[model samples]
Target: MSEQLMVVGEITAPHGVKGWVRVRPETDLDQLAGIKRCRLFWPDNKERLFEVEQVRPHRQIWLLKLKDVSSRDEAEALRGALWMIRRDEAPPLPEGHYYVPDLVGLEVVTVQGESVGEVSEVLFGPANDVFVVRRSGLPDTLIPAVREVVKEIALNQGKIIIDPLPGLLD
Candidate 1:
């Protein structure tokens, strides 16, 4: 997809017999509810534009009614189709909050400037997010995302500075 677009959800399965499809949403309920336009990515990198007709919470997932998708079979054919929006259309994030997509793949270093690894993944835990750093010839290092541990995130510089606990890198 273009850099201007970002994936916000995915069609998991067909909902009711009508056009509604189950969506695994990456955006919050409020944001998803406010979406009017979405680009659905299909097989072979093909895409189709859809006007969101309705969105409603259904247990852990969401039911989305898209214009032109008026049958269960139509919705079923869109299974695994990714829902995307222009990045500029996304709601502004609060200060100190970074989007998951923005955080991944950043270089990680220590306060003293020791190269640790690059961020391989960000695991969301009940307490906080964990940064999984992958270093060469070593097991992945799990760094807590607390303020004390993650001292600085220089997105412009494409790096992160961490104040590791004793024996953390050993």
Candidate 2:
């Protein structure tokens, strides 16, 4: 565990004239009200903890009002900010599922003992996620997150063992 922050939502846009921002949360909508605080990551690489003042459903999205953000311009300034929460604050995930930050940076290798590279990023899809393996000189490898392909993920060992499909790595 590399002290990874869980991305919970994103500030999409300013809502109305209040300091409320529309957020598209990654967590369950029913559990949104329980979130009272979070860490905000700015595009400039700055991060800060914010106490949630209020949060409510607004159609398909949720409206959020953070403490100290009291103007429409203030909320607008936070547009596109990634709302994150501490790993401990996030709900527990089921077995075999891992957070994005935990998977990133892990060494990737084939089950036959061939070294691929490290997981630099993960692309989420509707059906499955793809692991982006960054090789030394080769182009990044796209490893599909399927049981037949991904043999084992040993987070404790800091590596992911994959059984590449035929021509999948070529």
Candidate 3:
């Protein structure tokens, strides 16, 4: 696993006057449920750990109450803040499953070992995820995150093998 801290959610806005903040989760609900404490990363790169007092599902986001934030103003101050957890503390993935963060920056290669590019982004949709591979001066390539297209992901080697469909690179 990488040594960098992983962002799991973001404090979107203040909820009620009781220091609760609306969080847009980046991970699945099951992963969100396992988070009891996390570090709040500010824009200045400063981070502080906070204990989670309460967590409940909102419409499409989550409402979280941190232990120290006591007022609406306090929650408002936390706007745009990011919630992060240590890579080691993140929930373990099931067999054959990988975290999206782990895929970013991995070198994408063809089945025959042709260099494509590096993964710049992962777009999650209702059906599946898509990886945006970027190379200098070339348009980004979108690869579907499926078994047929994504042949193998060797995180330890920092490489991904993909079988591009017809016209996928165009």
Candidate 4:
């Protein structure tokens, strides 16, 4: 039950001048659409709660219509707004998947029990996510989050067991 809020989507631009905005969602479109209310984080560091009026997929992106935004100007004003939700309210993830917050500071080690470093960040790349591991006196390591490299994710132990592919940790 973390009180932290996580961003799920962002308003990219106004869609058709009908007060509908194009949204780039981070999670499943269905899950994002199911959310009745959300916290909108504005570009100027302002936050407000908004009710979802409508949501529909348009090509690859989604078009979202929020309550009280019935004009093109109103929708345009929310150009860089992020759609946030409570951590506990996030949609359930599939098995073996972990949220970014949970993986961020966990210990990283090899399958043979060799200490590597701690996960400082996760970069979502085009192919897969890369775990940025920071060590004591060594340069940061970039470990690709693949099944072959990420052997085990022991969240209960607060560590990630990896089987690095030869030059991966270098």
TM-score of each: 0.77, 0.72, 0.85, 0.79
Cα lDDT listed for each candidate: 0.85, 0.85, 0.86, 0.85
Best by TM-score: 3
Weakest lDDT window of 10 consecutive positions for candidate 4: 25-34
- On the 0 to 100 scale, the lDDT of residue 109 in model 1 is 94
Candidate 1 local Cα displacement, residue 118, angstroms: 1.4
A best-first ranking of the candidates according to their TM-score comes to 3, 4, 1, 2
- Over 1-34, each residue of candidate 3 has an lDDT whose tens digit, in order, gives 4667887789999998989999987765556566
Candidate 4: lDDT of 90? 68
Residue 47 C-alpha lDDT in model 2:
86
Worst 10 residues of 2 by lDDT: 25-34
> How many angstroms is residue 133 displaced in model 1 relative to the true structure, after the best TM-score fit?
2.2
How does model 2 fare in lDDT? 0.85
Better of 1 and 2 by TM-score: 1
Residue 27 accuracy (lDDT) in model 2: 51
